[model samples]
Target: MLTLKGKSVFAGITIGPLALFHRNTISTASHTVENPEVEVIRFQKARDESIEQLKGLYDKAVQKVGEEQAAVFEVHQMMLEDDDYVDSVEEKIRNGKINAEAAVDQTAQELADMFRHMEDAYMQARAADVLDISRRVEQQLCGGAGIDFSKYDHVIIAADDLAPSETLQLDTDRILGFVTSSGSTNSHTAILARTLGIAAVVNTGNQLHNDVDGLMAIIDGLTGMVYIDPDEDTLSQMRIKQQEEKACKARLEQVRHVPTVTRDGRVIKLFANIGNPGNLPQVLANDAEGIGLFRSEFLYLENSDYPTEEQQFEAYKKTLEVLEGKTAVIRTLDIGADKQVDYFDLAPEVNPAMGMRAIRICLTRPDLFKTQLRALCRASAFGKLAIMFPMIISVAEVRKAKKILEEVQIELDEKAIAYDKDMEVGIMVETPASAVMSDELAKEVDFFSIGSNDLTQYTLAIDRQQTALDAFFDSHHPAVLRLIQQTIENGHKAGIWVGICGELGADLTLTETFLRMGVDELSVSPPAVLPLREKIRSLDLNKA
Candidate 1:
């Protein structure tokens, strides 16, 4: 029996036959082609085919996982369509007179190397993604088959390191779990595993080998242990533990429809944050009372250029229709800083976190902002829809945003389009300035949603994305709590509702504290809703 240890990305016990995944070898020999133009055409055809394949994967992933994680496929498609990447491959093909496969391999290697040398860890991690996409194109050029695991049933997939695309393409039903020889906790594959609720252990080094394929294996995700051909005693113990864990999850599922009420009979709204309509299934499955943070950036991020008004309208309409009258607070286009889109042509900033992001971008570019407002307004007629602006610092920003929204409403009215005239408007109190001035800001909108993540970051002067500053990035710091409390109190004074729609909202340790502070709602990831509901049910807020 062989034993391996690694970090667990998700906790579950899965026992199955081990299945080794191997990519098809693509020949990238530097053979000179008779015609460079023909090679370029071949590359284009292969690139197009690869993109089509990614689209199918994206749709499948949406059904298996949620849209947020499925978005990796969309990003892969974007990477393939990137002009620089395409131009580099074509240039290499023409200059070197090499075959399409050779050109793509060379370009991908150069780009991956550049990405590996990037300063940001996230950027460096993308080197794997570049290689993954390039491999797909190469496979197509060489007429080679892609990785296929459908023949295996109930198997633990063991790979050197599964890329996001490779992980998503697998038939998830056949996958009992995943054990990788190498991967980080922050890798997209890890994120997808967690999203899919699959048992996963990564970074096991070179311990896993192809020789063990089809061997009986047990993955103890809770302990990050993998046992191959385990003794009867170990297998029996794991089987019992697996049943117990399953029971625990079933118990959590029992609270799916329970109201989030404190012992003292105080009720709080529990909603889910979503990026697109594709996440609706998770939101419904988790029994979210509403959609709190309907991020509109996905529409822009998934597309090559600005998404048309019609495209935006359809997406919002579908989400609202899916909710069947449940409230959906849709935030306007918030693309800058960490969520940058190249088409925006935003000038580089020294301090992008504090620079043109969220409301700042919308306010500065009303034409771009108006298209989204029109879509939201139009979709409001489908169901209960609310518009919320992010990164608001003052009442002036809110008023300016509202002014553009009002103009969109007027335009819709002139066009004889229907909309909800009483649709609620709100702002995200994600900055220290906004939280401090919440009393005045709340008066301009129907409600306030405190974005605890950004509020904590700006208040502490710490970059939330900087992992090195994690020890100092305290979301529960007294100052952040004070700001949240002050924001809630000020919103109440203005006769407006206040909610938390950030990572801190899902922190169960702070659930009672938030309830005591008179928070009206808590919006978090879909998976957190039932657990938060259970926590709320157990709390007697009156004791405070």
Candidate 2:
């Protein structure tokens, strides 16, 4: 029983034969070439071919995932055609008298290293894109056919790292799970894995071996374990687990259109956390009751400048329109630390995760905050809309944020722009301080939506994104649960609804416990909605 552990990006169980996915990296040993022009032609031909490949992959990915994600392929194609990339490769080939393959490899590494050195997390992620597209080009030059995934259905794939393009090109139906020795939970590969609903254990730190290829394996993404050639008893137990998973999924499908009400007639709202308007299709498909956390950070991440009110309003209004009459809690600008814009030009921090961010940025820059508030207020008239402030730790922060929101309302009213006058305002109870002082903060806000991801990180002093500390980052720790329960009680006492829109909310193990604790809502990723509802509907909370 050779067991490997990793960080789980998506939760599920899969028992399958192991398949090793290896990308053929072209060696860059400089071999003298006869004709430099011929080498340039080879590089250009390969580049064009890679672009065509991306276009085809984009079309297929659109069907498999969604438009926003599929657009990444287009971005890859553009990067390939970029002068920076093309000129660098051409210069290496012509000036250095190197072969096309060697020049491409050298240039790619240079650009990739540059991106990796960037302070911005988004730019750092782009480094993966550079390496990914370069690999595709290198594959084109080497005449290497991509991994034929069609041949290996129902297999757990182990790889050093999978580029987003490689993942999108895969026959996902054949892929039961993924175990990558190198990958962050925040990578595009992780996003695709979650979108495709595949169990993945990433950042295993190169512990996976080629010898394990074709060996039967159990990928327990929930626990982030990879079991290779388990004992008979363990295999038997895993098989039973696999059966239960399928049965649970089947049971969840029956309640697709049903309300998330406990057996004892307790009602709970189940909402989906969406990044942008493009996610609406999944939002409706998953039958999520509403959008609990409409992450507004994408506006800042996707743009090069501080987003204007008109730009922000269009995005907000589109989201509200899609939710139809359902509610959408738009968290205002959770930027800085992990999510930063170069335009913002925020200073470096010794500890960014706990530094100036989210509501902190908004409070200091009321100009930026008021713009988003005006947009949200205007969009509210289109559908049920709520404004949520992130990283709140006190009643003063909530009151201050609400004061700015009120100012925006007054400005809009004077300008004769129509909006929902009764739009609900809320604050994220993510910090230990906020959870502890929920009684006081609850009196200031219309509702309390606990951002358990940050709450867990803050309470346990764990960086939620750090794969190294996965073992210590316990979301279910009694300390965090006690805070959740207390916040719920406090919200109820103050006549405000309470919900959790974080990774912990999707945990089915705690669904019954949350219902028993009187949580009014469980907001999770769209994929988790139905399964969570199944758990909610099956629970006899009264009995518990």
Candidate 3:
């Protein structure tokens, strides 16, 4: 028996025989072509073929995943047809007089290398894209057929790494799970697998050999552990685990459209916490009542610089449009600390978590804050939109934020821009001070959202992002619970509703606790909504 540890991208248990993934490598020699124009034409023909291939891939991917995920193939198509990419290869063939294959490989390497050497991790990850498109063209030039994996079934995939295209093209019904030797939880393959609700273990450091293609294996995606040829006892335990997982999933589906009312008849609203509109499909698929938290900073993070008001407006508008009358509570410009935008050129802070961030940055830079506020307000008329401010510590800060929002409203009114004049506004009660003073602060806002992640961090005085702090960080600490209880009570006292929007909201163990405490809403990740609803339906909060 052999065991390997990796990182988990999704949580599930699967037992299956291994089916290895293999890519065909093409090698070419630099031949001096007689006519440079003929070499260019050859490249063009191959490029056209690759473009058609990607178009087919895009269509199929859209059917399997949603448009957001299928966009990966669309991006691959654009890369193939990029004039700069084509011109670069043509320049090599026309001037250097190299054959089409050699020129294509050389040109792809140059562009891929540039991205690989970037300081930003997000840009560096894009290097794989350049190489992926190049591989398609190179395969055509070498007269090789592309990847095909339709023959495999009832197996766990053993891959060096799966590109998004490969993951989308495979028959997922037959594929039980994935074991990749090179990938992170942040990789596109991992993201797609999680979105598709598949079990995946990544970065296992190559345990399976090519000859061991049919080895019996058990994968525990929750623990990031894989067992090959395991002992009888291990197999028995894994079988039980798999059965329990199946049972749990079946129960969750039963409550897919059911209201989150406890056995005691207490009602709890379940919402989704999404960073952007890309997660809306899951939000709808899981039957969430509304969007509890939309971290709008994502628009800025993905851009090289600050996003324009129109750009932010379109993103916010589209997200609300999909809600179809369900509320979308958007938090404005919560950028700082771990999630920083490069264009901001922010200097390293000794204690960034406790320093200028979220509402502080928005308050200091009214221009940046107002730009996002105007976008959010302008988009309000299109659908149900609620604006929330983060990192609140005082009633004065809440008043000040409202003042800026009023200024944006005035500017929009002067331009005759339509918006929800009576839109709901809220504040995140993440700090101890905010919780203690929530009675006063709640009077200034429409509602309160307790950001449990940050509330835990501040109350426990632990840097939640630090690996070493994992041992000390406790989300369920008495202090954190007391603050949450106090904030909810205060919001109610001030005649407003309160919700919990953080990792703790998804915690099944806390479902009864929050329900008994009268938490009006629980907003967690999309995948947790159905399960939470199941828990809610099973609980007797009155007895608790």
Candidate 4:
């Protein structure tokens, strides 16, 4: 029995058979197989075979996992049909006169390289799909030579990396957990696994590969820890713990319909964090008090340029109609370094996270900013609407932004455009600078919403994206906690409400801490609302 240890990032544990996701290496010689016509035929055949295999995988996923889970394959299907991708491969074959394998490999590398160079982590992750597709094509050309885990009953996948499409194809019931050599929590594979409630640990180094196969392992999804060949006592304890967790979760769900009031009768609002209109049904189902962070970036991304005033208005109005009287805090376009819009002529910046993003872009491009504000104001007439500014660093930025908003309001009034003049305006306290100056900022703004993700990042000067920096990026760090406390104090001092819209707001461990810190509201993922609400209802605020 070998003992291997890793940091436990996520908390639940499961023991099962181990499934390994081995890496594929394709070697093609450009100098060999000089016949261009024959090579082209070979490439076509390989591509066709790979398409069939992907379709087979898709069908299996639908049959076993259901359509919603298998929907990730749609991107793969789109890639196969992409005329640009196909043309590029064909052009390479024709010009280089290389073997079909060489041409396909070259094309795949080019696509992967392009995606890898993209600033957005999400987009950069898409490069894995290109490589995955290329590998499938190579396997087909080689008569499908790869490890077959179809016989494994319960397995934990060990891989250097797994693409979203590939990860979705696993028979999750048979597959217990996954340990990857490299991946971030934000990677699609990790995100999908979390959505499916599968246990996963990424960036566990290469040691996981050695003991992964045939190892009776206990994986903690929340903590990202893998207990290899656990002793009988540990295994029994883990089983008991798992059952208790399930019961606790079920109990938490029972309070879904309950109001969030502390023992002393102080009410705390629990709202949902939403990215798009698709999340509205779930938000309603979870009985969220309101929409806290309606990230409007999704709508902006699906289009080329800035969405028209009418287009933006319609989207916001639809969301408002769903929530009706409940307050929907619509955050203005937060696009910048991490997210890119094709239509916007944004210059590439060295450090986009700290560069012109969020309100910075809005302040610089007043015309674009006004269009969004106009749409938001128009939508405010249908339901309760609050405007939220993201990445606010200084009081002057807030003053300037509000001034522009006032100008927009005056224009709307002159044109007799229906709007809500009394709409509450808020700023996201995401920077350490903003958090420290919260008292002054609270005086200027109606409310404060601590974006803990960015706040922690900025306060500690730790890049959350770098796994090595994870130690310093903790939300529970003393400095981070102090900043949050100060922000809350400032808001209360100015008689303004404050809330948290980051992942910390949803964390079970820190939920009580946040409540004690006098957070007026907690905005989290739609699914987390009920349990968090229950936690709030169970708290004794008077004692605190």
Which one is best on TM-score?
3
Query: Which ten contiguous residues of candidate 1 have the minimum total lDDT?
Result: 115-124
TM-scores for every predicted model: 0.85, 0.84, 0.86, 0.80
- Give lDDT: candidate 2, residue 413: 78
What would the per-residue lDDT of candidate 4 be over residues 1-544, giving only the tens digit for each residue? 4444443323456777666665555666565556677877877788777777677777876765555445446557667667887787777888877777777788889988997787776567777778778777777766677655565567777777777766776667787777776665655566567555667777777645554577777777655666777889888977887888788778877887777787679899889998777567668877999988999987776464568999999889998998879999989989986787657778877787888788988999999999999899999999999999999889899999999999989998999999887899999999999998998999999999999988988888888877887665677899999999999999999999999999999998998888888899999988788778777777786673
Please state the error at residue 286 of candidate 1 in Å: 0.8
Stretches of candidate 3 above 4 Å error? 27-52, 77-131, 137-144, 348-351
Better of 1 and 3 by TM-score: 3
The sequence of per-residue lDDT tens digits that candidate 3 reaches over residues 1-544 is 8898999888899998988887887875688988999989989999999899889988887888878877778878877877889999999999989899999989888997887664444556566678778888889988958777876788898987788777777777888988888765755677688788778898899756777688899999879999988899999999999899899888788998777898889888799999778789889988999999998987886675789999999999999889999999998888886676668877778887887889999999999999999999999999989999999999889999999999999999999999999899999999999999988898899999999999999898898878787988888999999989988988888899999998999998887788777799999989889888888888885562
Evaluate all candidate structures by whole-model CA lDDT and list the values in order: 0.88, 0.86, 0.86, 0.79
Of 1 and 4, the candidate ranking higher by TM-score = 1
lDDT of 2 by residue, 1-544 (tens): 8888888978888888888886555676788887899999999999999899989999999988978678788888888988988999999898888899899888888988887776565677677888888888888998957876576678888888889977776677778888988777767888788778888999887656678889998888778988889999999988898788788778878999987888889889999998877678778988999999999988888675778889998998888777779999888899887876778888989889999899999999998888889888888889999989999988888889888888988888799999998888899999999999999998898999999989999999999879899888788999999999999999999999999999999988888788888899889989889988888888886583
* True-vs-predicted CA distance for residue 541, candidate 4, Å: 2.3
Q: RMSD, model 4, all Cα superposed?
A: 4.5
Poorest stretch of ten by lDDT in candidate 4: 1-10
